[model samples]
Target: MKYISGIIAILLLSVFAACEDETKTCDSTLLSDLGMNFKKDTLQGFLVKDTIWPKVTLYAIGNDSVLINRQPRSSAFMPLDPLHDTCRFYLQLDSIAIPDTLTFRYKRVPSFVSPGCGFATFFSLDTVITTYNTIDSIHINNREVNSSNDTHISLYFIY
Candidate 1:
């Protein structure tokens, strides 16, 4: 019984040591190679008494063909009501392919009531592509626009 207990304790210690070593392996080089980085902030705001409209589209240019489609994802819009101090929105890419460039197009429509104050906003679009060995590169694009009483459109790209 004593011998068996000792063997069990030794096995447990080995497993714990292996786990500790694994944690240290997450280095910056690995992150960079995988094209991973800390994400920046992008936000946009509009001040209007009525409703607002926003839309986004992403296109991918592959070696074979050109793909143009909607992101098929949901986004949040904050009305900036007096009760709520701030609003939040979340945007994400549906899918991404390797060795390809992506183009983004955005449009917004705003309506105002009393027009006491205009709206202020900022926003960002990011997509990450991964491979079997490592990430080739990370590309990020951002844009901001303010329209008090008219419609607006914005376009940009990331490669």
Candidate 2:
């Protein structure tokens, strides 16, 4: 009976150790999503840095899943594909009939974290392509995107 209790205690300790290790891995490695800030621009070069959209819908090209669905927001975060060097998105603002397309080109740097933890992806912004249907211009704030959720790009809408 003592031997059985000892074995059970060892198994419980092993389980607790595994849970602690998983927690550490999760804390270290996180999904790095690209952050975007919105702004309003006038023809006279007046810039409103923190412009809020009444409603915004966002999704990726070639994917039916919508990332954001008609939400009022001034900033958003979009995930980039670690397997691909480029990602394309379609965004509709304030019930606009025509949606603007944003293409992001980046260099993906994958870091092998551990055997149990797969990898963490970091991105360096290369270029951004946008359809000017509703968007006026784009500004790259930070070229590097990683675990920190900082604004990497800013979108300027013509007022």
Candidate 3:
């Protein structure tokens, strides 16, 4: 009888241990919270502001869909000094898939321009729509142009 009782106690302890191990609390702030329903994969987007001088707007699109509406964001803009000729912007994404085509639209705000340029140019621009698959990375650059200097918008994505 003693031996039987000991075995029963051991079995009960083992059952309790197993139950404790099986209980797990799910994290509420997971990728699912972001609306990404992939069971075995995750998608994320990040924006990298390279500079704060010029102060332009940045937008992002994925699979020809506006992931980030053309919202204005600070961009690298400096006084039209002889030294500065080009403007740079950056955005980052991880574990994302690019659709067949993506479109980027940007408008530069003239308010950020210095007195060097006679009149601000708001050059509405769009990229040569192209498709992307398994895009591991991406970057966008708006070269110097003499056009309307309104808040500029651009699109970049990765898969």
How do all models score by TM-score? 0.18, 0.76, 0.19
> Which residue pairs clash within candidate 1?
42-123, 43-122, 43-123, 44-121, 44-122, 45-120, 45-121, 47-119
lDDT of each: 0.28, 0.85, 0.32
Question: Pairing residues by index, what is the TM-score of model 2?
Answer: 0.76
Off by over 4 Å in 1: 1-78, 97-147, 150-157
Candidate 1, residues 1-159: lDDT per residue as tens digits?
Answer: 769999999999998987665433432221000011212222322221221112222222222322223333222221221222222222223333322222333333242322233333222222322321112223332222222221122111122
Considering lDDT, which of the candidate structures 2 and 3 is the better prediction for this target?
2
Q: Model 1 — TM-score against the truth?
A: 0.18
Model 2 lDDT tens row, 66-132:
9999999899889997889999998988796478999999999987555556678989999999999
Candidate 3 on 72-99: residue-level lDDT in tens? 3323221221222222222222213223
